[model samples]
Target: MDVKTKMRPQILLFGDSITEQSFRSGGWGAALADTYSRKADVIVRGYGGYNTRWALFLLHHIFAMDNRSAPVATTIFFGANDAALPGRNSERQNVPVEEYRDNLKKIVQHLQAISPTMIIALITPPPIDEKGRMEFARSLYGENTMKLPERTNEAAGVYAKQCIELAKDMGINSIDLWSKMQETDGWQKTFLSDGLHLTPEGNAVVHKEVVRVFSEAGLSAEDMPYDFPHHSIIDGKNPEKAFRVQCS
Candidate 1:
């Protein structure tokens, strides 16, 4: 690496609560921030309870309102909220799967338009293995009446596989962390108490997976551990009363 050779620009990570945590409160975003030092500035634009439309809306805002003065590289994750119908806990698994793929493609297109050299990583959502959660989903949709499918680990898997295929078709970079996590002895060991979000250990796993992807892609970023302090779930929010980190 020539001293004169400019390092790749900072990575701009965009997504929902997951990415948001990496930025606003600090999770993988913080890990990347710490490991990369000043080489890259990871801008996390995250929103809780936001779907693909909202993520795209934020992306547009970043483009039209913020800096285009500097070029950007990115890593993206979404689809957790999209799988659920707006304002409803039931799986919007009803929405044509193709539409989900299209929304993400649009997001990718927007990133490309902003910076052709941008590297985007599409991470599949982590596993949701809460026994109570499945019942809750069933109750939310009254699916028992219709025999709607149980809270799906498959839906996220399907959506992510679609993204991987999309990336392949377009010749881009992505990491199927979701698939890999499935083999991690699962959420039983890594999840926060809530059973939805990740514990630091879980995020550490996510970090390692991201590192594997970036390093293999030959992106310039160091490999480091992902361990951030637990963030409080204040504001009387977060549905799961038991939801707080309990990492291994």
Candidate 2:
């Protein structure tokens, strides 16, 4: 590996579609990258439409136990597709709530095993808007699409509750997006682009919350040392003087 890359620590973002799209124009992942600019690298490992069950299979591959430099922090955001209604077309993605909780536990355990000191944060799925989902479905598949929304806010809330409880039981941080978004008036319209996915405004909320939790855990970017000296520190007459010094 290149010296520069090896020198920088990494913060990983792992999850489903929400994480995969987190680098969009106003994505939370992008916001974090900007916040952590020279401090640490933010790596995204998002698989769209994946549930906790399938995620188990990739843990060994994506986060090899033998890695010398594991991430300092990681966020696991999932449960959206797993909350899919059983009889719906998306039923294939549905995972029982009990199993969902257990799967999350396994993920946490695996990460902890890889790096006991690493920070892990669990993000609950956002609430659903039944009407918005119907409209979106019709737009994509026509009016003849299924009459009922494939997912419900109530169902998602159940998963969210489990996720938060698991975080507490395991002694880790958690972002209760499902409850937080609903606390705002008309969040159904302001936060979600489709009933299931986040809008830019929603992404902003996530960015804000993640930063808050990280800061509380002493991972504030402002307090972190940059990988190299600032440009101003370089002497134009002898720039090597700055580069030769130990990394900040």
Candidate 3:
């Protein structure tokens, strides 16, 4: 393929609703795309309300080993739905804590098989605001809703810690959103939208963490080449020359 037309390496964001919403206005995924604009393609594959168990079956379809466009890096983010409380949509999304950790290991192993060099990052589920989430849940399920919320900050923290531990065991990077977001007072009001989802400010937090992790993994933006010369730097008289990727 012509160098100019060559496919760029990808940074895949794979997860559930949080990942799905990562490209929303002022979202972390959008920020990453802009930051890596000419360097790498930031692709998102998010399945709303999906747990790790459901994700396992679909992983092969998303990252076929035969595909030439292998991702340079992949973020396997889950656990939010997996942390769902028993008897509250448990049949649909909940997974035991031990199983949750094991599923994450399986995911990493699968990615390693696809490409041993592919950088993997695991993101712990962000903390949930039980009060706010319960309110939201009540609104969705009516006043007759159950006593406990579908997800809770405490439960999410447990899963988050496991994710961090899993990352250490697998020798991959991990982002502890569950702990970082709650470090400050009134974090729930500032960072979360409806107890479960992220607010614009929350997205910013994730964006910063993503950059931090990517940098630590030696994938700094400064080190990556722009896909093409900046428009301002292009010669107006011969723009095509600027557009062409020079053969080394």
Candidate 4:
């Protein structure tokens, strides 16, 4: 890249399916892009159905340390799959809570190595609703649905606790989606679409929380400068005059 070429600072959203699906209509990632418009680029590095153990493989690839234009901040949101109940169809995704915690630490460490000043935020897996999971399974498999839910709120809580503790130990930002969503009545349906994934309302919650944390950390969009001159400041008769100063 040419040194004179302007590149917008970036914000990376990385994690599992939830993060992957965050750019859907009314999704949190889209909301973030809108919020950071002209200030920074929001990049999504989500992998559907991925867990922390699997995520490690792509860390260096997705965030090459040598890249001169590194993201200003990143959000690591995994664990929903890692919390899968053992002995279930989704058991393959289950990871020991301790291992999950360590993987998160490793991810954070790598990002810091890339850019020590880059902000890293960890988001806990959202709560699981066994009934919702079962219903969703039944819709696909009818009576053939698994006899038991592949995930449970209790198991998710365990992982969420580990995530929260890890964030505190690492001195980074953390979002307790598990607890935050449950604070609302009927969150199982209101915030979650299929027990695990987020509904639009749920995405709104994430967007709100992320903005709050970022704002407190001195990353509020209001404080950020636009990458180029605002339209209002541009001279209609001499557009080059406005851009030339910035280009120089």
Best-matching candidate per lDDT: 2
Residue-level lDDT of model 3, residues 41-74, one tens digit each, is 8999999999999999998899897766778889
How well does model 4 score by local distance difference test?
Answer: 0.92
The per-residue C-alpha lDDT of model 1 at residue 23 equals 45
Error of 2 at 192 (Å): 0.5
- Over 53-109, each residue of candidate 4 has an lDDT whose tens digit, in order, gives 999999999999888877889999999999998899899999999999999999999
User: Which parts of model 3 have CA positions greater than 4 angstroms off?
Assistant: 2-7, 240-248
Regions more than 4 Å wrong, model 1: 1-8, 23-26, 85-95, 130-150, 222-248
Candidate 1: C-alpha lDDT: 0.63
lDDT of 2 by residue, 1-248 (tens): 65766777789999999999999999999999999998999999999999999999999888999887789999999999999999997999999999999999999999999999898999999999999999899999998988988999999999999999999999999999999999999999999998888999999999999999998988999998878889999999998889887643
lDDT of 3 at 72: 86
**lDDT-better candidate, 2 vs 3:** 2
Can you list the residue pairs that collide in candidate 4?
none
The per-candidate count of clashes, in order, stands at 0, 0, 0, 0
Tens digits of per-residue lDDT, candidate 1, 1-248, equal 32211343556677777877764343777887766664555666777656676666676777653454433456777766666533334454334458768888888887777777666777766655546455555566566543443335666677778878888887877777667666766455565424446667767776776766677766655443223222454335653442334222
Lowest summed lDDT over 10 consecutive residues: which window, candidate 4? Answer: 1-10
